[model samples]
Every structure is written in C-alpha cells, then in structure tokens.
Target chain A: MLPHLQLGAEIEVGPGDDAAVVRLPSPRLVVTTDTLVEGHDFLGHATTARWIGRKAAVQNLADVAAMGAAPLALVVAISAPADTPAAVFEELTIGLTARAEADGASIVGGDLGRAGQLTITVTAMGSLPLDQEPVRRSGALPGDVVAIGAPRLGRSAAGLALVLGERALVRAGEDGRPTIMLRSIQDSSAADLLRWHDAPDPDLSLGWTVGRSARAMMDLSDGLVRDGRRLAAASHVTLDLDRAALAPDVEQLTGLAAELGADPWSWVLHGGEEHAMLACFAPGAVPDGFRPVGQVLAPTAHGPEVLLDGAPIEGAGFDHFG
Target chain B: MLPHLQLGAEIEVGPGDDAAVVRLPSPRLVVTTDTLVEGHDFLGHATTARWIGRKAAVQNLADVAAMGAAPLALVVAISAPADTPAAVFEELTIGLTARAEADGASIVGGDLGRAGQLTITVTAMGSLPLDQEPVRRSGALPGDVVAIGAPRLGRSAAGLALVLGERALVRAGEDGRPTIMLRSIQDSSAADLLRWHDAPDPDLSLGWTVGRSARAMMDLSDGLVRDGRRLAAASHVTLDLDRAALAPDVEQLTGLAAELGADPWSWVLHGGEEHAMLACFAPGAVPDGFRPVGQVLAPTAHGPEVLLDGAPIEGAGFDHFG
Candidate 1:
C-alpha cells in the first residue's frame, strides 16, 4: 500500500518480516524517540497531516544530529481514529519518507493502529563516524564558547503568536499554506516567521560539523534559555550570554513584536521549536556555519543558570507538564 | 527519579542525553515498533498502567525475537494527560524497564509528552547472532514442517472474553490483581486464562533456537489461521494442518470454552495475541521446544490458504481496521 517508499542499501531486510534489519556503519548506535500528539504538538486547523509527519520526523532527526551521528533509519508508530481518511495516511507517509530521505535515512518499518486522537511516535537510529566521538551534553569545559547553528531564533514562537493571538490574521489556504491577512502588519518577515513555525528546517549537516569539534552539544527545541540551562546542568557549568550578541535576533523580531505588542527579546530568548543546533566549543574552536552566542563558566552554588548580559534569566521556555 | 534502572555493558551512553548510544553485537541491527493506545488496546477499568507499559514492551520484544535476534535495547515514547499521577508514571517506567531487562535489554532512552489519552510506543533493537542468519517469512518451501514454539494458544483470547463478556464477575482488588467473583465459573484454569490475557508470557529464548534452524518464522500475533495464511502467502506456499495436531491446544482450552459457552477450536485457530512463535522448519528439523502442527505445500492457482485436515479454514484472525 505504500508506494515510492525506498529502502536504502543499508537495509538488509526491509519491512514485511518480523523486523527490519539494517547494516550499521559503526558498532555504536545512537537512538532517540519523540512523540507528537494532536491538540498538543499540533492543531488540526493550523496544520495538515503532511506537516505533522514532517514535524515528527524532523524532531527526532534533530536529536540524532545533536549527537553528531549520521542518520540511518526510522521506525514510526502511528495511532489515529479508525475512520480517518486514507488520504491522510498517505500524505503522512509521504511526508515522513520525504523528510527521512532528505537526511539520507529511510522509514524502514512502522505500526498503525486505532486511537481517539492522532499520535505519532518516531524512533530514529544513527551511527557515529569512524574517526569522531559522540558530542555529549556532559563534555563542556568552563572556558568553552557557546554557539548556535542558526542565525535567528523565536521565529516559530512568533509564528505561533500570530496564529493564537491574532487568529483573524491567519487563514488556511487551499494548498495548506497558511495565508496571513496582514491587514494589521506590513512586515514581510512575518510571513517567514509563520512558515518557520509551520515547518522548521534544522541544519542537520551542521550538526555533523559541530559534533566533530564541539565539547558539548544539544538541539535547541525548548528555546535557548531552557535548553541552555539543560546543557549547563549536564556539564556542571553556567552559560553566560552576551546580550549584544542576541540583539540582532531580537531586532529582527521587533517589528512583529510591535504588531502584537509583545517583547521581541523574550521571543529571541524563550521562544522554542526552532530545532537549531546548540553547542559549547573550545575557545576559537567554533566550526564554520555557526556563530558564537555565549561562553560556559564554572559551576556556582546557584547550580546551572543562563546569564544574559551578566544577569540570570528567569523562567523556562516550555514544559510539557507545566 | 529512575531508581533501580541499570545500564548493561552494551549501553555506551544511557538516557538523560539527547540520545542513547549502544554497542551493537553485529553490523546487522533488527528493529521493530508497536503502539498501545488507551480504550483501543486496553480499558482503564480492566487494566493498570503497568500492564499497559509491559504489554507495549513485550509486543515489540516479541518482534525482535521472531527475527532470531538478541534484544539489545528499547526506546519508549509516552503521551498521557497532564493530570496523571506521578505514581502512574513510576509504575509504568518500572513495567517497561522490568520487561526490557528480562531480555537483557535496557530502556536506553524515552520521551514523555502531554496528550488527552494514554499512549505508549516502544521501539526495540536486537542483533542477529553471527552464527545464524535472519529467518525471513519468505523462505518456507513445500514439505517443510510448520511448528509452534508454545503448545498452548487462545488463553489470552479466552481471558479477554472473560473480562469483556462478564465484566460483573471481576473487580479490581487492592493489590492491583483482578479478584474474580467466581459466580460464573469456579475453575482455577479460568483464572490462569484471565491472567494470561492480562500479561502474556512468550518464551523469547525459543526464538533464538528457532532462528538457528527455521527456514521461515513469524510470531503468531494474529492467531494461527490468519498468520499462517500470511506466512504461506509470503513464501508462495500453502500450510496444510492436521486437525489432530491442533487437538492438544484445543483440548487445553476446552474446559474454559465450555464454561464460557465458547468454541475451543475457534479460539485456538482464530484468537489473537497468542504471541507464540510460528515457523517452518526443514523436514524433521524442528527444534526441541517446538512441536510440529502442519506441513508446507506448493501453492495452487487460488493462492495461499490455511487448511485443516485438507479443508480450507474460513475467516481472518484480527484486522485493526476491520
């Protein structure tokens, strides 16, 4: 029933068996899992099945990238209402396969079942390069520099604000692309921000480059401040950011923030779902395609903290339970 | 928060990072995933969170076993309501870890999220032993012996029927075990059947033995009749069973069936979730723990069929959509 589903050479035995067998590039296997639930990870009105599938695939792929591993394969388990349209399943499969193939990975196997709401759980496998070690979140040194793969942050959060705060400004187009009425906002960047939220494009290749040189690394999904705190906690260090370094990103969101009467700096620091790679590298060891955003410091009695311009930042980005 | 969770030697990097790293025993990695949803997979009143968690792990582990591989690790993704008690999560984690550890596998990593209903998705990884090849579902040939790992079947189905058919006869006890009211049937075997349905115990070691000898093998999840057809279709052969060969299994369930006014043979042939290993072996090559039940035959123009005493069996076991 699944057409255009291609299995890479690594797959020794594809689906239609008890399990799928794949040849690993190395003995070390890097694995991660993520779950996306309807009404929580996504909303029916704001996204399509294709986008949901893409988001599900990207989220786990980003985890593999964070470890500096080459993507290998993914096993997805989906549960939706029994009466869901077959077209939805087809689009979701296409989205999942397309996203995985883009990263040189394959959807080797999956399970489908009935549920009251849509849920997608993806488990992604990757392998470490022969010459490189995995960049863990615990290897950061006190003098390491904090860097980010992407130039901007908070675009997804801004896009979400546009949808939630000013619902009238966003409308689902026939092509599934959200069309902004833009009657109240004249900024062209708003459209890009909206698209970012709809579909995040994380720089996965850059993850490999950072993995080779970074002391500690992680993907920025829960905003810079929250995930930075996590990296700091894991490494037993504090991350101190230069406020001026983030000014450009904040400035980029200023126009849209004004349109919605929101703080641009808050979005830059606390907005999430960007899926950018964040790492701590030795002084002057930051790789190409990355920009320094902060520095790691020795631990203090206050435990792990993210400092903005010498002052500690308050509040976290997102907590599934909180 | 995860106490008593121990990482095996195979785990290079365990949870609390972006991903877990495990050392593979071989270049070939076997992977599978399964999802269990609330209401659809289990009922709140009839089962506990721990059973749900265990079932999720066992189903995926059985997939790994069916491939004749030693389970390496498991990655779990859970989505549940925000108001769920902390104890529920603890018990669920214990269930998952216990099941994985029983197979010498670790719960290497997991993700938790918020959803309206409970959902557990598990992805299990295993390694093909160097001395053996993967037993595919397409290698059965005419005259090969059809053998089953377990002598008994339909116990799980009988248990489910007891719960769903006569709910008033069971009540939740303080110890989490169901207390049978015993008004319908006082047979001790009926209680065993109920327990089997609640938590199936599939012998995984037998999978390794079968993998080394069987030409084609699959776990019987959807009952003998339906899955036999699948194995036959995959191998381009037909499976002709001797009714006398299945008489033992039918007799095992006869007492319970009579008490419930159900057909024993129907449950033995058509009940789902038995999770016993089914394989086609070279003539007279069945393993010690397995017993012969049928023989492979050349496919006719009508395609794959499961026959009993030379008569075609009618009806499928279970179809999620159907």
Candidate 2:
C-alpha cells in the first residue's frame, strides 16, 4: 500500500480524489512538465532510485524557478516494470517528496502503472508574487548585460565523464566488479564532481531574484552555448560572451579535464545539466550573486548568434531527440 | 520544426518559455495527470496515433469534469523512439490539440524526448465555478440514489473483444492480413461499438451539470462494479442496484455479446474505460439526463458492497498492475 501523503494547507483536496484542488497565490499559474526515461536519463546501476526521483523533481522545479514563480505543487506519473522492487518505489517517493518539500512544493497527486521501462513525468505549478511580472525569454534588448546565477559550470558534465570512464574501465577488467578502479580514483574533487552530476542543487532563490529584475531569463540545462543561442534567438539579439569572464569557471574544471584528457573550456561552454539561471538585465541592473559574462547586441541579417571571445563557437550539447 | 500553436485569451504566455502562465478562473486550481504507455495503454498497430492522442486527452479531461471544473489548459510530455516517423508525431499532436480544443482547453506547453517506447503524459488544469464546490467521493450518505450520466455501458469492452479476436485470427492466417476477417464482421452496430472503443466521446457537459448537485461523484474508468465499490467504500455505504434498472443497458449490448460469444451482463457490469460519471444524489435530487440505477445503504459488517438485483456481484475489471 502507498503511504498517506500529508495534505498541505494549500491543498483543499489532495490525492485519492478525481483531481487535486490547490490554492493559487496569484490569478495566473505557471505550468511546466518534464519526462525522464530509464537508460536515457539515468543509469540504474550508477544511481539510486531516490536520486533519480530527486533529479526528475529538480528538472521541473528548476523550470518553475526559471519562470521566477514561487513553487506550489507537483503531480507525477510514473511507469515501471511490474517486477520492480517495492523499495525502489518507496525510495523514489521519498526523493520526490523530499526535493519538492525543500523547494516549498508538495507532491499533490500521482498515477502508477506498468511499463517496459521506468519513466517519471513531473508537472510543476507555481505562482508569481504580487506586483511582479514573469520574466520572458523574448524581452532581452540590445546593450543588456547577460549574467549567470552561479559561477559553477560544467561540473556535472565533468562528473559524468569520470563516472562513465570508470564504468568503461570496470567492463574492460577481468572482474566485472568496479571495486579496484573505483578505489583508484578516490579523489575528493572527483567525488564532488560526481555528486554534482548525480544530483544538481540549482539556486532557485536566485531565479526568484532575477525574475524580479531581469528582462529575460531561462535555465541553463543544455549548456551555455546552446541555451545561450536559444536565449539570443528568442530575444532577437546576439550574445557576445567575454572569454576573460568565463576563464575562472573553466579553470575550475581544468583538473578534471586534464584527468580525462578533455578541454576544460569546452566543458564550461558546452557542458549541460547544471540548471543554473541565465538572464539579461539592463546595464547596472544586474544584482549580487550574479556574474556578468556577456552583452546583448542588435540582431543581424544572419539572425541571432552566441559568441565566445568575439568569435562564434560551435556547441556540442545534449539534445533529447537529436 | 514544431507547428505554431495559436494562443487563446486564457493563455497569458504559451509554449517556448520555461513554463506557461495561464489565467486562472478560480482561486483554486484542479490538477490531474495520466500516462499512456505503448504496450499497456494501447497497441500501436491497432489504434491510430491520432486516436491514441485523443484518448490520452479525454482521460484527463474527464477527471477534471468529474470535479465539476471547467478545463483551462493542458501540458503534455511525450517520449518516443528516435527513428519513429515524423508523421506519427504530427498526427499525435493533431489528436492532442484537436481534443484539447474541443474541450475548451488548449495545449499550452509540452516536452519531447527519445525513448524505446512511445509514451504520453498529460497534466490538465481546470477551474470550479464561483459558487460550486468540488464534489468528492466521500460525501455520499445512506438512502442516496445512485445515478449514471448515461444509460449505455459495456460497448467499449465488447468492441475491444471483437477487435482483439479478429487480430488473433489474422495472425493465425498464412498471409497475416486481417482485411477479410474485418470485413466479415461489418455490422453497423458492431462498427459503432468499435468506434466507441477506439474513441470514447463522453458527455463532459453532463459532468459539469452533475458536479453542481451530486453528493458524491467519480468518473468510471474501471467497470461499474469495481468503481461503484470504490465509491461505496469511500463514502462508507453499500450500493444496491435494481436489476430491472440495468436491464436496458445490458440488452443493448446483447447483440454484440452474441456476435463475440461473450456475456452482455458481465460486460455491462465489469467493462471499463467508459469514463461515464457515477454519482450519488439525495433521494429525488437526481438531475435530468441521468438515470437512477441504484440506492446507497448504511455500511454493514461485511463492509462496502455493490449489489446487483439484491445480490452481491463479483467483478474482475482491468487492473494496471494486477
């Protein structure tokens, strides 16, 4: 039997009903959804069900935050094989509830069914604060400062590389077990990187702050270059990111990059899954806790472009279908 | 490229952003989500992508109607194999958008991804009228009259049997083609039954009307016996049906049952996916357009039960994880 979900004060009628009724903070509701497929979104062996649940919740929570709205509630629909462990389901619920609760939201309702693969679909709802307008992706103007909510970038991608590399080594060895290889790379920084990749802690508070002041905003899930290009295209403006401003973020990844024989700058510019907020603010409107990395320019005949150090840089980021 | 979605007045901000901001009708929002998997929810070959899309939308739409709420918007998340034909996606979208539009709701936003099997998760939001409160499942009392939104039942289940039996015969043949078998069963009534199975058109208007006065209400996705039992348990009452009242509905299905060598009474009592509204009304409070089928009684030591013609009937309805 499933555990009883505590009904929050905002929930007039929670789970077990035809639909849940939740109090809305504003007259408008911000809604978004995301689906995570097994093998594609997470590796079963490399991650716990709890972490997978956490990741799934965070994906949508970050989207709500990117809208600059206060999180309200989440409804999830999960499908998995019938033979899946009950403990996995329990752990997943814990992860989902824990993450949503931390973000000031609750799992209001859900549906469970049998499927060939495990899939989690989360729909997040949020409300804007009184007198605040939602920051859109099409509001950027020429001369606006492009800033990032956090300096940490590419840590998740670097951590993924380390984990995948270790898995490959384990498969190549005589014994399939990865105990020896895992011990060989027991560095603290690598552990930190792996943790970041496993479960990202996005600064949702910064998203709220930016929503109040930024003209345009979005979350960086698909890396700087790719998502930056999206922001530029949406706002009909070109973004020119300064190399000097990104050097520190890239330098932080140099150690992991060297260990894996990769480029740190590539990780910083093109790695994804960081869930950092990227926004455009009027000159001098950029707030604290955000670092200026670029400037918006008028659109050209060739359309919007994202530049690095005055030159266009091709970005290789994850695409769900591509 | 995705087609441009027309923005309705209710949609403050549509797709292309982190989330959509939709104007709410009431201070409380009704939310629900449902997922349809490739193998479990439908057979890809047997059902067209468009019908599949419509079924997905209606499932959630009916849930909102059961709450007596006016549907506002829907957000969908779909996952399919990367190599799937683009036409399939287009047709599915056509189905989803068409159905949502028919219900006075728009497909405000969605996410797409690659997966081994095609999957769709829909989250629907609705608003209750200013004076009406949501009818819950636990509000029924003893002596309440049990009513049904429509007198027709079991047509969908009967149709499914005919289709599946035909599919089995087709696979047994040398050429593995079902055209001959399909043509052999070309009764207009049978076609209507199959059509109902393929795409159920539940009268959602009746749902809104019933929500205004029903003491307890739920959409019957599971068979009447099973879902009726659920309603009985939720309200701590036993539902005793008069066999004479259900005779007409069962007689309607007798012809299809004979063609398929099935039991009409069983289908009427145990068939599911009808999405008909089952409600309890205070004695003599049953609204127009709804047929009284049974009456509620106080719970006994045997617990909640659904009786047919003064005797308890066993129902083996479809269970997702059963």
Candidate 3:
C-alpha cells in the first residue's frame, strides 16, 4: 500500500522485510519519536488522513532539526480501525512520503495493525557532520544571541483558533479579559494560517546549516514564550526578548487577527506547532535566514525566566493536560 | 516516573530532550518499529500495563535480531487517556526498561500524549559488524538446512489457548474437527506457557552469533507453518520438514496438551508469537544453539510450498485479517 516510498541508495534493504538496513556516513545517530492520535491530535471527521500524515512527519523532522542534525530516514507505525477504507491508508502513505522527501529523508519501513482509533507514530533518525557535536538545549550561555529561523510564529495557534471558532479564542485567555477580538474580514492569510496548522512546512535544513556555529537550539513547538522559558531553564540563563524585534511577525498576522477579533500579541507569544527553529548563537555568528529575537543573560536567584521588554512573562502554551 | 531507564554510555543525550543522540560503533544500522493498542493487542482489563510494555518491547527487539543485528537502543512513543493513573506510566516504563536492558539495549528517548485508548509504539535500532552483511529472508537456497534456535515453539499459543479458554480453541479449528481437547490440567508448565504468551523472552544474541554463516533468518512471530511458507516463497524453495525432528517440542507440551485434550501437533505447527530465531544454514554450518528441523529444495511448478514428510502441506497460521 505504501508505493510512494522512494528507496534511496543509502537504504541497503527497504520495507517488506523484518527490518530495514541503512548506511550512515557518521557514527552518531540522532533519533526521535512522536505520535498523533485521533480525537486528541486531530478530529478524524474534519482532517483528512493525508494531512494527518504530513503533520506527523513534520513534527519529527522538526525535532531532528532542533537537535542540529540532518534528517536521514524514518520508520512509521500505524494502527487504525479494521473498517477503515483502503484509500485512507494509501493517501496517508502518500502524505508521509511527500513530507519525508521534502525534508531530504525517506520512509524505510513500518508496521500496520488494528486499533479502535487511528494513530500514527514516526521515529526519525538523523546524522551529524563528522567533527561537529549536536547543539543541545543545555549549551546556551550568557551573552548568546537568541535567534529564530523563519521568524513567522503563532500561525498554527491562530489556525487552530479559527478551526475551533470564536469560543476557542475566547476561552484561551488566562485573565478575565478577552484575549482576541473577532471580526469578519476577507483575507487569504487566514487560509495560510489554517494550512500551517493542518500541515506545517518546517525548514529542515536550518539545523545542519547552523549546527557548527549555534550554541543551543530547539524547535518552536510550544510558542515563543513557553519554549523560550524551557531553553532558558535548560541553559540556566534568562532570555530577554526584544518586543520590537517580534513586532513584524505580529504585524503580518494583524490582518487576520483583526478579522478574528484576536490579539496579535497573544498569538505571537502563546501560539504553538509552528515548527520553526529557535537557536542561541555567539555574538556576530547569526546565520542567514535567521533573525535575532532576544539575548541570553545570567539567571538571578529567582531562576531562569523569559522576559519581555525587561518584564517577566508567565509561562503559557500548549499543555495537553492544561 | 522512568527511574529504571539506565542510560548507557553510548547515549549522548537521553530523555527530556526534543530527540536523543546515540553512538553507533558500526556504520550500518538496522531499524524496526511495532505498536500495541489496547482492546486489540491487549485487553486493558485483563493485561497489566507492565506486561503490555514488555511484550511491545520484545516484538521490536526480536525484529532487530531477525535481521542479524545487535540491539542497541529504542525510542518509545506512548499515547493514553489523560485520566490514566500516574503509576501506570511508571510501571509501563519500568517494564520497557527491563526488557530493553535484558536484551542489552537501552531506552534512549520517547514522547507521550493523551489518546482515547492506551497505545505504545517502539522503534528499535541495532548495529551490525563492520565486515558482515545482514541475513535476509530471500537468501535461502536449495539444500540449506532449515533450523531454529531454542526450538521450543507453540508454548505461547498454548498459553493463549489457556487464557482464552476452551471456546477460543474450538474456534481455531479449520475443518470443524476439534483441534484441541480442553481439560483442566495441574501443571506449572501451563503457567509458564501463559507467561510466554504474555511476555516472550527471545534470544537476542543468537542472530549476531550465526549472522555470518546463516543464509536466511527471521523471527518466528507467526506460526511455523505460516512463516515457513513466507521464507520458502521469498527464496523460491520448498521447506520439507522432518516431523520427527519437531516431535520433541510437541512432546514437551504433550503433558499439558494431553490434559487439555488438545492435539500437540497443532500447537507445534500453527502456534505463533514464540519470538524464536528461525534460520536457513548450509548443512554443516548450523550453529551450536540451533537445531535442524527441515531442509530446503527447489520450488515446483506449483510454486514454493511447505512439505511434511515428503507431502505438501497447506499454509495455515495467524492471519490478522482472517
């Protein structure tokens, strides 16, 4: 059923076997796994199987990118109801194939079984250059320049808000005040935001491109504010973000935010699943396609925290329990 | 919660990161994935979370061993109900850690999310010797000796029949004749059989030990009759078995089989999930732990078939769809 998988030369043996054998140029292998479940990660009725597959692949590829490794191969495991249509699996494989190929990786093998709800788990492997070490979250230091590749953020959270309607935006506020202001305005950017939420397109090359120079890095999956706090905590430093530096990203979404009656700042700070690369680099070492968003600083006795314009911001983002 | 996870020195980074980095001594990597879903792979009411995790890990480890690779590391992705007890996750992690360690591998990383049902997907990666090539299913040739490591098969199926009771055995028959005669038997082997069915213990070292000399190798997940057909078809050969060679395995279980009024031969030939290593070696190349049960011959016009004492046998084994 998975005809779209292209067997690369590095794959000594592909699917239809007990396991697949692959050749790696480097001895260090970067590995990660993630899963998407029906009714939790997606609404099976609203989202197509193909898009679900695409989103699943993007999540793993982004995780590898966050590790400063080049994507290599992925093995997918899928469990669905027995009554599910054959076309659904075909489309899902096609989606997975397209996304893996786009990220310069291939789908080498997978297992299929029956379950009550449809779930897809993808485990991705990656490689690093012979002499370079992985850029870890614990490597950021004081005076490091905090930057982001593909600076546009929060579009996914915006898209999810749109999909869930006005109540979703209204309920997202921590305080009693409305977090977003909704209005009807015709704009294609809203559609783009929705597409980003449905199937994110991450820049997979950004990790390997900055691997040699970046001090620390991660995928911006849980919003700028929440993930920024994690990066700071991991490195035992404080991240002081410049609000003006993020104003452009907010401005780009302002058109749709106004129509949805949403606060652009809320989306910029708390939106998630954007799948963009966030990294800390030495001064004067920021690579092309990355923009400075903040600076790393020594943590006070209060512990590592995210600061906006010299004021501490409370952590808030996608929490499955919350 | 995952306190039992003993991170080996090969793991550069463990859990709590976006992904993990591990060192592979060999350039060639063998990868496989498998998933267990509640209500299908296991009944949540009947199976403990720990045994489920153990079985899930064993399935993947055996797949890696089937490829003649040494198990190195595994990444697990779990999805469960948000209301699930915290202790359940702890026990599950302990189970995964135990099985992985027993097989000389480590749990390197994982992701957790909420889902309607508890589900786990494990992706295992293994390494091969620099000078050795992987043993593939299609490598068997005419005149190869068909052998199996730890030749005690069908214990898991017997255990399953015991757990499922008499009706399950009754429904397993193909021609309406009683395949098993159910009767109460006072034997600890019955409990041992149940344990094997629940959490199989596969010989992880057998693969790499015989990898260089074995012409073909695969894990016996399905029944011997079923997997043998696959091996025969893949290699364009017929597997002509000596029933006398398999009599000992059936004899071991004959005590319980006779007590239950079940035919020992049925379990030996059609029972699955033993996770034993099945390989084809040159007549004199069979390794120390392996015992010969059959021999390979050229396929006839009717195509590759499995034979018993010079007579062709119809294919019968575990079919998920069937």
Q: What ranges in model 1 sit over 4 Å off?
A: A1-3, A166-185, A320-322, B1-4, B168-183, B320-322
Docking class of 1: high
DockQ of 1: 0.80
Error of 2 at B143 (Å): 1.3
Q: Candidate 1, B162: how far from true, in Å?
A: 1.4
lDDT of 1 by residue, B212-264 (tens): 58899899888899999989999999999879988988888887778788888
Alpha-carbon error at A164 in model 3, in Å?
Answer: 1.9
- Per-residue accuracy of model 3 over B1-322 as CA lDDT, tens digit each: 1456899999998887778899988878899999988777765534466777788898899889988898899999989888988767876787788899988899999888988889999999998877888888899999999998875888987777675563222221232112323346576587667667767886767987765478998888888888888889889899888899999888898888777778778888888888888899987899888899999999877899888887976647764421
Model 3 error, position B203 (Å): 1.4
**Model 1 TM:** 0.95
Ranking by DockQ: 1, 2, 3
Candidate 2 CAPRI level: medium
lDDT of 2 by residue, B194-278 (tens): 6566567777667776556999998888888998988999999999987888899888887767767788888788888788788
Q: Where is model 2 more than 4 Å wrong at Cα?
A: A1-4, A166-187, A320-322, B1-4, B168-187, B320-322
Using TM-score, give the best candidate's number. 1
